[model samples]
Target: MKKHWSVFLTTFMSLLLASPVAFAASPAPQVNAGDTAWVLISAALVFIMTPGLGFFYGGMVRSKNVLATIMHSFFIVGMISVEWIILGYSMAFGDDSAGLIPGVIGSLSKIGLAGTAGQIVSGTSIPELAFVIFQCMFAVITPALITGAFAERVRFKAYALFTLLWSIFIYNPMAHMVWGGGKLFALGALDFAGGLVIHILSGVSGLTLCLLIGKRRGYGKLPILPHHLPMTVLGAALLWFGWFGFNAGSALGANELAANAFVTTQAAAAMATVSWVVCEWLHNGKPTILGAASGCVAGLVAITPAAGFVAPIPAVIIGLVGGAICYFAVAVLKAKCGYDDSLDAFGVHGIGGTWGAIATGLWASTAVNPAGVNGLFYGNGGLLVAQIISIIVAYLLGGIGSFVLFKIVNAITTFRADEEEETSGIDIVEHGERAYSQSIMTGESLGLPNEFNKMN
Candidate 1:
């Protein structure tokens, strides 16, 4: 009741402020110290998540492929960073892009950050440059997420090419449609952050790559254990830490909405962690640290879309749903489908993201944010319908788009490494390097032949 009153008062006040008299007296938008600082800091936090993801995924693959796995995420940071300022950012956020299909892509007007610099972002206090760098962090992580699916057997050069193309064709357009003032935004679909743009897109793309690239050699035939568990836990910690910025920062201001998002983000992540461990304990007789980590991430993904529009309790419910749903996706569904989705990227991020988006429609409240709509529980089912539509669109596009991108990339050059390279381990075969120095110490001690030691 209090929240309802608050929403009513806020709305009433907004109307009053928007009147003709208020418009003339209102101060011009200027740089806001707090919002700018928070957003920039949030960008930095998000930047750390890619390497953290590398550690999380790296720890899950076999020791021989750890370096290769880490390299995928680490290198995308540099690759996408360049791509962003070059043309990627323009394609994503450029205002003038009424694309070939209107709202599907941004204009190339801002290519190379051409005319966008220290100028203020429209309706925001931050400089255009700040928004560019902040969004670049998101672009970097999306492709890195796909690397987990095709981890060991992928040719690095081919993977690199795919990353370039995927960002251009798949990621950039999707980002534009949702957050870039594109069709979805125009249609009233509300994505506070990037449940559709990032998670769903990457998850579907990850699955597509797995099918196109084929499974890692000896996938189900042999148990491939994590080379290191502690690294994964550390990576999860970093991801959770970074997500506060990802969720809260999306508010684009250090205001009540940002505070709400911050609190909801933590609540969802914590609840999901508990729910995941509990779910695993009941089913498997013991809950592993991996379950806990996976659960937390699932929770984060689930709450992202709802962070600003729902209260803490709903966030907890979203997390619980995410935890259980993702567990089933990875454990039961993956086995039945026979796809080796290494690290369960499709299960965790994809499923969690979809659920989170729908949950937004179920739990969102005008009371929490008048700028947002009420959800089904709050007496509107229309938002839920839009959420479903966005989910379907994302899956279809990500799947079909990834397939085409793979065909194009493969026709140009082979995407998969040869059998000999796979057998020898990708780190040594492709990079001429090892993840651990201990391999070197043990190599000479074992008295292996010089040719064998070459790892090729």
Candidate 2:
């Protein structure tokens, strides 16, 4: 009896000693309240940007196509939201351990968010659901940004199909490559927010699509002016407000990195605004509100990739140069190239994103975020090379992927509206509605006047 008791006691002690190590090997994640709240709030902020973008683009288009233009952004919010829930999130962030082409895309292990419940993100204290929702907002807005390129000319059905396909093929793979431990991440390229993934991809794709879709009827023959500057200004304000979330939220925590990003975002935007207005004043002899709004956006785009890696001063220089370059692209390059990018999507986003990416390589510093490496000015040229390579890859993916998707969409249905439809108005032809009941200029009822008005 004593021998048996001794053996039992010894075995129990050994098991107890081994339990802690076993648990330590796969410890459960702990949630942080502060981090979770910040991420959720940031997600909400990004969600509003799509509608804000609608108003911005809608105000720039002719009055006859305003509703149709706005519809593009609004509808995408619904369409892409559903797509993300179903498969987008999985393809964008799922583990690639089982992928046949590892580092290019993700596996479908998390499809429909199957195993996400009660799970925490790998490096953060937030729940996996929080990350999914935040990224969903990004996926929703990217394709919507493309609408500005072919506004007032694309068939609604064709636009819908192209956006869905583009999200699946272009946006998903790119997101994985940059943020999901894929090829770009493995290659040590840094994109703090989305210079290569969002701005460059959408901008270049917009350029390709606009070229393929042809110009709006009378694009060069007639003057195409914005119908509502106030609305556009309001839209710009919303975008500016939301951008703090876009840049800072990328930090994934409410910490010093987030604070730094916030400061840099403001500094870059302000400097860009000043530089753009000054440049316009010098070149055109006057500064326009449109120029100010466009400049601010350019600066925002240019600073996105470097927000976390750079200091506030570097951000300002980036913005100053970015605003001027984008202005030139819109004002001079568009005119010289003779391509009708209806709203300068390529000019501001593509050009700004390219500059921002290269600037990241030029100005990035480990001092700002120890996770990141130094850039050219900080005594490292390899980062600059990486940035250039990423830029080239982005251009190729955006241009080639968009071309193929456009062709497929066009084959399924006529991509561009007919000449008669263009003249009559896409709002009425595509949506059977008008933005306004009466024309402010003529005081006349718009959109095929009612029988009583006709009789009058």
Candidate 3:
């Protein structure tokens, strides 16, 4: 009996030793340093997009709330960064214990990313830290995008609480469903860069929040002209540059897939920008640079879901459709619907995301992405049906979840600044600072009458 046991143990050890050699004999993955470096840079580039968002949102609002709007984007970088490190990553990516929520809150208990360096997840050569950092950038920008809808009115305290709650309840769960080992990923939903999970969800949440908060006082009556159109333009340029990373980096490797995503992103943005401008020129009698930029962003948002799955032509079509649809949504639906999306977050991101998701179902093809499914145009109508379901589910869930969370937050602290404080402007009243202090000081220093103060 002892001899038989020894023989079995010896055979098991021999098999284990031989298996690795057999596997090594198969084709090995070519680890390209240039590709790795490019992806790393791309990840950092995406992280830069949050600040670009801050500037874009900052310049679009009246100067009164410029800093306040920027702060919301800035705060997202800090708030969600910590959340991602603590519970967020675990909830999304950890072992699927119950096949629902990720098994343990402390599954990633090694806080401060202890021992994360040099660690490798199976099937990939990249360090686990690289994946963590890449995903962290996604978490940072998503809530920042929502700030556009509630730009001028929401109190800082309420804003902070809402973002915290959102990171926990909305962003984390949707991320798990769409990207992590959850039912949605299991069901074969294709989201290359978070069109449904981030853009649509945040867009719906933004719309709901703005509705609940009501319009800014004297919204229609007030001119509320953007204080710095040039700044907004520059910000848009930055967004365009940053988006290459946002879409391409999702491929996680600098391979043909990444190159395809890059081209698709550019084509979509260009087509959408042109389509939006043409539509606006026809309807509004002229196309403003603001409209052009907005159209580009709408296209970017729309193409995000289909970036990896669709070819360049379909990407362009998707962008054009997104631009046309989002333009109308911002121009027509907003006023008639009586929702005051302060910076058009709902009109652009929400509507664009919905269109993009549907477009993915329409344009997806196995030629560009073998792992992805073919869409309706490729004779797969079921994919389109699934996309529609995804859209409805995302909007309803995100809208309701955000509303409830805001209510809870509002109950704890006043959600809006008092009328007196709001009238005074958040920079002075809330932050005890002004955005153009130097300009104000210079104006005061000059004996001549201050045109800026008079304009204000």
lDDT of each: 0.88, 0.89, 0.83
Pairs that collide in candidate 2 are: none
Q: Please give the RMSD of candidate 2 to the true structure.
A: 3.8
The RMSD (Cα, Å) of candidate 3 is 4.7
Candidate 2, superposed: residue stretches over 4 Å from native: 1-27, 441-456
lDDT of 1 by residue, 1-456 (tens): 999999999999989877978667968668888888989998998999999999999888777788999999999999999998899988988883455456888888888899886588887888878788889999999889888888888888899999999998889989998888888877677789889999999999999989888887767765567778899999999999999989999888789999999999999999999988998898889999999999999999999889999999999888888899988898889999999888888998889999999998899998988889999998999999988898998999899999998999899999999888986789988899987775553244578665434331
Predicted structure 1: lDDT? 0.88
Q: What is the TM-score of each candidate against the true structure?
A: 0.90, 0.93, 0.89
The candidate maximizing lDDT is 2
Ranking the candidates on TM-score from highest down gives: 2, 1, 3
Residue 260 of model 2, lDDT score:
98
For candidate 2, lDDT tens digit of each residue in 133-194? 99998999899888889988888999999999999999999999899888988888899989
TM-score-superior candidate, 2 or 3: 2
lDDT score, residue 152, model 1?
84
Which candidate achieves the best TM-score against the true structure?
2
Give the CA lDDT, 0 to 100, for residue 372 in model 1: 90
